[model samples]
Target: MAEPAVRYFFGQDGTKLAYRDLGVGRPLVLLHGFFSSGAHQWLHSGFAHTLAADGHRVIVPDLRAHGDSAAPHGAEHYPDDVLTDDAFALIDYLKLTTYNLGGYSLGARTVVRMLVRGAAPSRVIVAGQGLREVTGKGGTVARYLRHVFSHLGTFKPGTAEWKAEQWLTRTGGDPEALLHVLDSVLDTPADALTGIEVPMLVVVGDRDDRDGSALALSRTVSQGTHVVVPGDHTTAITAPELAETARTFLRDQ
Candidate 1:
């Protein structure tokens, strides 16, 4: 099927947000990672299609400052837990009383924040993140992104930072707005994991350890399962197994 047309909604702060709705069945909201849009992360990778095919009404949003969403350059536009707030706004706009939620990397982190703050999605898929990242203890991913943005032109060819910068350029990320989005990242307390009463799945690549241990993060959730797929943080999202694993988890009840 052709990709669903992008839709618009006003956020709690009145900023226009962009999202795509597809398939029909249980509502499933998937958030993309930082510096990426729902189209680039989900549509391009064919991930949303697989899940939608499996009896889900997939809703993927371009988080504020990413994709077709409104990207305000001023720092004042972003408040603490802004992404989390945006997710809640989308849910409210869709009038989804029951649904499944999932995301990757920065998006995955946002999913954890939503749960700790009391989002009751029937099932959840947190990929490419670990406990330390959620608890604000893992600064590796944030630090790396900051380094790339802060020293934009300084990275040498073939270096990791340069590679990231190249990817950011390809994604058409707004550097100024994304920096502010970074400042809004919320760190959930380890103790808050107890409050998540629904089934949660933590999927991490076998070679990925950027945000620490995915297994450890899964163990913290009362009803969590950890799945190890192939590839690292960057490559993992494109892995076919990633989509299959998520589809299976979401279908298992």
Candidate 2:
């Protein structure tokens, strides 16, 4: 399939976000993982191309702090609610009342949160995420900090070497921002999951480092279907098998 041209838009808070519009079926919105842009996760992964080829209108966006989006100055600026609001804003901006939603890792967490908050889509796909693990002790902020510090010197800001840093900085990488996002994720109300009425697909890689947690989360959704594909977390999004499985699920829905 030909690469779909990407378009840009502003979220409610005025942060610039970019996404790709592909194919011609039901709208399928794809949210990418933290620190990774939509292009890197969806476009580069070949997932977007495949979905477009399968006739699904794919909408892949760079979340507020990542990719072509404008990075604001504080972590608090990227709170879960704000992120959810961004999704809604995007949908409204596109004049889409209902569509399908999916994401990987942090992106998946965002999808679940949006669902909990009543950001209803036609169907939802939670890929490469296990909320059970995320809601545990550390939450996204602590885990991200660990990943950042551990991988320190491995990436630089600005150029490709600093992609993660660029994202972090864009979202206002101060201590306050970290605490805000952490608290939001850890304290997400339980009633949120129980209220969702749409079909849900929980996907994870069999060989994922986070498999145990992902499985635990899949069990939480009231009307969820689980699929274990081959490969690790990153590969799960890029692998042809996983992409095809997602396409099938969306089509069946």
Candidate 3:
């Protein structure tokens, strides 16, 4: 059977954030990685459709500045808490007291922040992010500028350029907002992960850059499980093993 797509929008500090909903029954939100929209990460993944097939409703949104969502022009607009609030707003807008959550890479980072802030879900699945030191390189401002120039005249929406654009957009394409988010990522408090009690499954590819960190994070969480699939960062998304692993985890939950 062909899956149906539902369009919806929820307010994020007064601005509308767009989302695509599919399937029915229990709600499961899927967050995409740093340089990709929810469509590319979840819908294109076959993961979204698969979950829908199994009687799970999926909510996929392009974070604040990515995809077809609103892109405000300020640093204050994209802070970690603010971004996390957007996710919560969507949940409340849907009137769901609780649901399942999953994300990859940057999306995974947000899920961790959500968990820290007490946005507890029935179960959580994080891909690409594990445990790693939040190193201090330069401030968020410097990183944001670097991102903008790095992708100048380079990335478009739906090709190899897509990844580049994804990173550039998150950095805000504006210097101030870029710096703000970078700083937020670097300066995030350590206590955030000290006591995550929700059940979690952290999946990483054997060759993924964050493999070691993912394992470390798995160990840190009180109830976390780690799975390793074949291939590197990008390939892991399409790898059969990853799909199977995700299916098993979500089904079991």
Candidate 4:
């Protein structure tokens, strides 16, 4: 397997973004979760290697403000579903008319956004997330963003907010810009997710009921499949079964 190499591309607004390219076959784009970049969430977890070894050319982008990408700390840099737009830009840059795309957590939410925006990836995998995030009011995301941006270092250790701070700090992400992204994604209409024609695999941890059922979400789409893996939200992302599930779906005979 070829080692992943760092590459650069420009977003719609000219913000330079970074991505890792590996292997040599079908292009598989993997988006990482909130506060986590492509390197830690996908590469470090061995998920990227798994896909690459399965006869795929893996493309993992470090979303703006989350990795080696330019982290602009302003609202203007983040429009509604802008992260998805960035992904689309990468796809366009690669000139790939069809490819496989997937993500976990925030990246999972992004898959839904891409579907709504009419991206026609040949296959999609949404892991570690559930229905509410894709179709609910999204109040919790806004509240969490507000808490992080407002309080910053004030959150005590051992709490979720404090842990969140650490994750953002690892990539030198700007909290204000993240809040803008939250605002942009929250504006997406809940009803837009239902009749998507794209074939999707919604894989969530069986115990991750906090965000509603992944099965329920998949059933709404015309060509969706649901897979229940072990563990909760966080643990599910690193589960070996996730890579296996993805390999099976993307390589079906």
Best candidate (score: TM-score): 1
Clashing pairs in 1: none
TM-score of each: 0.96, 0.81, 0.81, 0.92
Cα lDDT tens digits, model 2, 1-253, are 5566768888766777777788788788988886677878888889888888888788988776566666666655665467677877888889987689998887787888788767778888888877564455325445666566356467654654366555556544443333344444533454566667788888899888677666666676677778888888757887888788888888886
In model 1, how many backbone clashes occur?
Answer: 0
Give me the overall lDDT of model 3. Answer: 0.72
Instruction: List model 1 lDDT by residue over 105-185, tens digit each.
Output: 889999999998889999999999988888888887788888789999898999999998998888888888999999999
Error of 2 at 74 (Å): 4.4
Clashes of each: 0, 10, 4, 0
Q: After superposition, how far is residue 20 of candidate 2 from its true place, in Å?
A: 1.7
1-253, model 3: which lDDT tens digit per residue?
3434545566566766778898887899888875467877788878788878778888998776666666667666765556577778888888887589998876787788788878879889989776763222224423554665456666565764565556555644443343454444533355567688888999999998778878878888888899999978887877777767877887886
Q: For model 4, where is the 10-residue window of minimal lDDT?
A: 182-191
lDDT of 4: 0.82
- Each candidate: what lDDT? 0.90, 0.73, 0.72, 0.82
Better of 1 and 3 by lDDT: 1
Q: Note each model's CA RMSD in angstroms.
A: 1.2, 4.7, 4.5, 1.9
Error of 1 at 84 (Å): 0.4
